[model samples]
Target: MQVLNKVTVAVKGMVQTIKYPVVWKPSLYMFLSLALSISTHEGQFYWYTNKEPPNPGFSQEFVGMVHAVGAVASMVGVLIYHKNLKDYPFRSILFFAQLLHGASGLLDLTFVLRWNLALGVPDAVFVTLEECVSRVVGRVRLMPMMVLSTKLCPPGAEGTFFALLMCIDSLGMLVAKTGGAFVLRALHVTRTDFSNLWLAVLLRNLLRLSALGAIFLVPTADQTDVLLPQDLLSSGSPAAAAGDEEERLLQLGKLTSHTDDDV
Candidate 1:
């Protein structure tokens, strides 16, 4: 998880340097891919336990197949979206996807609580779908946050900014996982208990939803420049066209330049 967080930070910082609208689209797709990867692992595990055979191999196989299929589907999605990238707002798509993802997680919790084998299959399916959707939304959530962090750093300190983001994100993940385990243990709950597991799942989804909501409060690419209209106006038409563009460029440049000067 730590390593993955680091990679995410790196990717976000790198991708923000690319063209807008275009960069935003790919980030969504990538986020969906990430979501799929995460959701599938849990789904596969659920499937294995629910099945009569309870074979770990079957779970592994299921994950592998889904991953392979996802790879192909993602490639196709990228190609299809390439032409219409700018038509969609990345944040809008991301919010919808996250809502769906949270809904799926909630459904999973419901099925677990009820111990409905009949419902379990559908729950697993929802999880699978959420996984796919997450791939797109995850990137949406991650990239914007990274871009914001990069914007706040001193000039030429992009590496430091990225490192801090990674560290914080990884720490959050570790705390979440560990805290979850502790909660379960403290409650004397077992994974097989439908009610206990469901509660845990519900809490997890709630946390995720809250996090998503928090992202909405941050200034968008456009709103970031509200603090400095004069600086933005000085940059001319291209920079003035998108406030976010000017703010991001100036912030990043200042950070990078400052770092160079410091060195």
Candidate 2:
């Protein structure tokens, strides 16, 4: 019963989160689009590389090397975000990341066209470089998402609300995977054959680009301090706690009921 109550409260908080103009709207739309693009790209990567003309399959060693390089690149991305991007608005960081990642999807098309092979570059090297760069940017991009999700949790119900937000993210991943399978089936892409892989890459890139349209849903400033439970608890005055409780009530009321502005 206690677990059920927590789940209920968590769900209620999630509903409230959807009505939060600065958090939920952008997260919902952009997150889904990005997830779909990521899922499409990931689910198709093996087939994309294996279907290369003149070379039917990627060597396991070469794929391992590329993955090793990408792992290192991801670590570098974390350092870069900490040093260079920590001060930027979360929305701006996420926007640029999404755009850059979308542009990188075009690299898949270039691979399909065998553009680098024409320039005397080995397929292994080209794939390694592309994977490295993509991993770096992808890691940087995901940082803001976790931060924003944490920031959206309301006072007193922080644990419940944060868990609900994370569940939404996980749900997006599941949907993305399902959507990618549907696209593959729809396009008839399979391991031994990849006739329509170029179309798949294009569609994934377009979906990534489409996520940019939700930028307005991001808050312009760091607003996490607005309703911190700790702030209320640490006020050192009974009146302050009472006032905060009233404010929290009003805020939650606004969240549950449909106001014209909320709509």
Candidate 3:
């Protein structure tokens, strides 16, 4: 009961913290964008796994190669963002991320349309390139939100707050994947049927572009300016420390009472 009450207070405190527009706006924007970014991928995966008569098949080794290259590409994306794009305004970077992500979404369309084959590109080569580009763009899109997460952390609870932000990211990813699966199902994309995959690709790109509407949620000004109030910068919530102190005192009182009983 005591622990439950404490948890309720902590949750309420967190609710109070997020009530600030500066806090909630950007968080919501990140969550929605992350969630929506993945909604169009199921069709592509269906086409890949279910490539039948007319469609080309990707070899298992090549698929593994694509995954490996994608991991490296993600690292490169983060490095490039931190090195070159970190100083740019958050809105500008995100605007370009949306545009670039939309453009990358085109590669999916090209693959689905077999335009690469028409253009004399081998399926193996083209798909790997597409995977690398997609991973890089996705990682780049996520970087600014990560940087913002740190800036939003209150003075004292930085680690816990950042972990909470990561949990939000995970939740967004879950929603994105689930939403993507639903889109695939709605389009009747199956292991053996991917006739409508191009539509899914188009929908994904549209969704990526749609996030532009929420760009206003992110703060345009620097956190040092007005994003965080002076009081917030000065101190953080000491709830954990206070709880520890109270628990210590209670334990000490109990120990003293036990000693008296022993006497």
Q: Backbone clashes per model, in order?
A: 17, 0, 0
Model 2 lDDT per residue over 158-234, tens place: 67666767877888778777777888778887776677877877887888788788767666665233423343335
Alpha-carbon runs more than 4 Å astray in model 1? 1-47, 50-58, 67-101, 110-127, 187-195, 212-217, 223-263
- lDDT by residue for model 3 over 10-56, one digit each (tens)? 66556656677787888888888888776665456556655475576
Quality of model 3 by C-alpha lDDT: 0.78
| Error at 37, model 3, angstroms | 1.4
The window of 10 residues in a row where model 1 has the poorest summed lDDT is: 32-41
**Candidate 1 C-alpha lDDT tens digits along 72-150:** 6555545444443323454554555456556656544644444444444544464455445544444444443444444
TM-score to true structure, per model: 0.50, 0.77, 0.87
Who wins the lDDT comparison? Answer: 3
Tell me the deviation in Å of residue 231 in model 3.
Answer: 2.0
Rank candidates, TM-score, best first: 3, 2, 1
Model 2: how far residue 239 lies from native, Å: 21
List pairs with backbone clashes in candidate 3.
Answer: none
Error of 3 at 23 (Å): 0.6
